[model samples]
Target: MGPVPWTVNSEIYPEAYRGLCGGMSATVNWISNLIVAQSFLSIAEATGAGPAFMILVGVAVVAFIFVAVFVPETKGLSFEEVERIWQERPQRNRGVAAVPDQKEPLL
Candidate 1:
């Protein structure tokens, strides 16, 4: 959960979109870190470090569920392979319409 959002965004895009997506993701990650660094001390002061971290733990749980449901296991998958994997899900379920399944391995 820790840094999962920070790390994963840059990894999931297709090869064609990776440059654009990676840049955007890096910006978002750094901005989020800036905001948290600036705000966390105040938040902790207003509501103790223990409670603040507990809230983050709850957020981590939610993030875990999100990843489990929405993120595919892309390990050992090429960018095209990962794209095909995600495109396997029904449009009704989420995201773009299912592309026709390829018979050849997605290298």
Candidate 2:
């Protein structure tokens, strides 16, 4: 996955929803992992794993295409600026804010 939306969303979203989003993201990741773990043997048996691997590759390709075409870059911009850009776009979904920069020295 890329860095843009993840960075943007974490910054701009309400604090309450941030944890929820994070939890959901983690859950989806774990679920996908579980699916892969449980199905790899079966997939290998059914289609020699080549087809299963190819399907994953295809899915990644499609996801990359969608992200490249639709997601905007957020690097080097403030969270608010990223939010403004997201809001201005008609086709884009809301993105998380960039994490705040710390100017004070660490204690």
Identify the leading candidate in terms of TM-score. Answer: 1
Model 1, position 65: C-alpha lDDT score: 96
Candidate 2 lDDT by residue in tens digits, 1-107: 43434554576544557778776766666777788789878887889878988977887799789868876776687767766775677333224445444799667
Off by over 4 Å in 1: 1-11, 90-107
Q: How well is each residue in 31-82 modelled by candidate 1, as lDDT tens digits?
A: 8678778888998999999998887778679878998988888777676777
lDDT of 2 at 55: 75
Give the lowest summed-lDDT range of ten residues in model 1. Answer: 90-99
Candidate 2: stretches off by over 4 Å: 1-16, 90-107
**lDDT values for all models:** 0.74, 0.68
Which candidate has the highest lDDT of all? 1
Q: Show pairs that collide, candidate 1.
A: none
Residue pairs clashing, model 2: 8-96, 8-97, 9-95, 9-96, 10-96, 11-97, 12-97
